[model samples]
Target: MAGQSKLSELFIKCKSENRAALIGYLPAGFPNQSDSIKIIKAMIEGGVDAVEIGFPYSDPVMDGPVIQEAAEVARNNGITMAKTLEIVKEISGTGVPTLLMTYWNPIEKYGPAKFAHDFSDSGMEGVITPDLPIEEAGVWLATAKENSIHSIFVVAPSTGDGRLKDVTSNCSGFIYAASSMGVTGTQTNVANTASILVERVRNVSGTPVAVGLGVSNRAQASEVAKFADGVIVGSAFVKAVLQNPSDPATAVRKVAEELALGVRER
Candidate 1:
């Protein structure tokens, strides 16, 4: 097969149908762990094509204000790596492809090899480590692959051509392309930049590219899907729940529905 299973095949299937996959991200224990699971289940019910379960870490330099706050809330609520895996197991019961987005620190602390085996057993479809560049991916990559866990890589707007090929060469699932130059939550009118990166990644990697990091609205998501296989809505979705003046679940469901509408429309 050209691309591995999990998200890669899922996006290919979606693309064949002339549709873009919707990948939603939410921290494991944001407002609360129980509430987080409920929101996840609701997201699937609301038509999310795939889900990224974020494992909250302390030094998330790439995240924006909203996700940083959500991580803090999760940490304050005592959401550890072990508990997060349990949550992943619970969510996988929904039968949707769910990946774990995390930093390398926790994996280092927990040991990448062991974490890979256990995480796959816990039902994670894949793992996305933005800070773990391809050069540094060794044991973790091998271990994840050995256990059938997809190991994803990220490519940014500033990534050069040669390095772009290196980044996506052995990537298991989809390649996450950062839309802007800055952190995860900042959105700009850089559709052309995103499109360029998407084309470059496709040219080299022949892998599915999902644009993330600043996509917060239906229009933005729709615009991005024009050239990308999928769209990742993160900070905006987290912001929706936090910005809810009244009901947070409603906020999540609303954002989820809007993105689903955006992806399905075109």
Candidate 2:
């Protein structure tokens, strides 16, 4: 059996503190490789509990405009699978648990076993493949198990009770609960359905649940934190970098700090 991952440890620590973990996301090589590394370090300095590095896919169906733009910038700057893994190595070295959020095509093209092993070697504690379903995740799950890494899965408000059980059962680190049934982005108000989805996931499994999508500010983070084990913010962070091209590191750090306060306040 695979041992407990850093991601699992983070959730436990957060639970003990009576607060939700703050997870921040950034695409590898966004703006540029060297600067991207600095930006990730800044996020850590700002109290982000965990990090999710995007793999910069050409067709990110689940990503919103902010994230898609970041991915495009990273791709145009020559970000590749190898480069992404290098970024993972640098950030994971900070002792903060790191995860890669990517589409299934990249993993399929890279070869599942090799991909899993390489990712594990890069110090990533888990992987979140949004497009891959539980029924089709047999090989990937097995390889992730062999690597002693967690196979994270997504559960949305639209997920039915039966399917929720199957999906959560296959997940190891945490179950990603999409707050709404839409592409990822920041919203003025988080959907009420997020809490409902979290409740359903709890009824089916004991895995920690993290709510993502539509969470951009501290208030939204605090609201979600009230019911979730973790709060994931992506587009908001990407937007911060985009808005402050002169010094994206500082920009993202500020956003991380604000969101961190939100989670802790909850």
How far is each candidate from the true structure, as Cα RMSD in Å?
Answer: 1.6, 1.1
**Tens digits of per-residue lDDT for model 1 on 97-216?**
889999999999999888987888877888899899988898788888778888888899889998988888868778899887989888688577899999888888766888888888
Candidate 1 deviant stretches above 4 angstroms = 1-4
How does model 2 fare in lDDT? 0.91
What is the TM-score of candidate 1?
0.96
Per-residue alpha-carbon lDDT of model 2 for 1-266, expressed as tens digits? 34466788899999999999999999999988999999999999999999999999999999989999999999999999999999999999999999999999999999999998898998988999999999889999888888988888998877889999999999988899999988989464574889989989999898899999999998999999999999999998899999998988899889998999999887
Worst-scoring 10-residue span by lDDT in model 2: 1-10
RMSD of 2: 1.1
Please state the error at residue 212 of candidate 1 in Å: 0.4
Score residue 165 of candidate 1 by CA lDDT.
85
Best by TM-score: 2
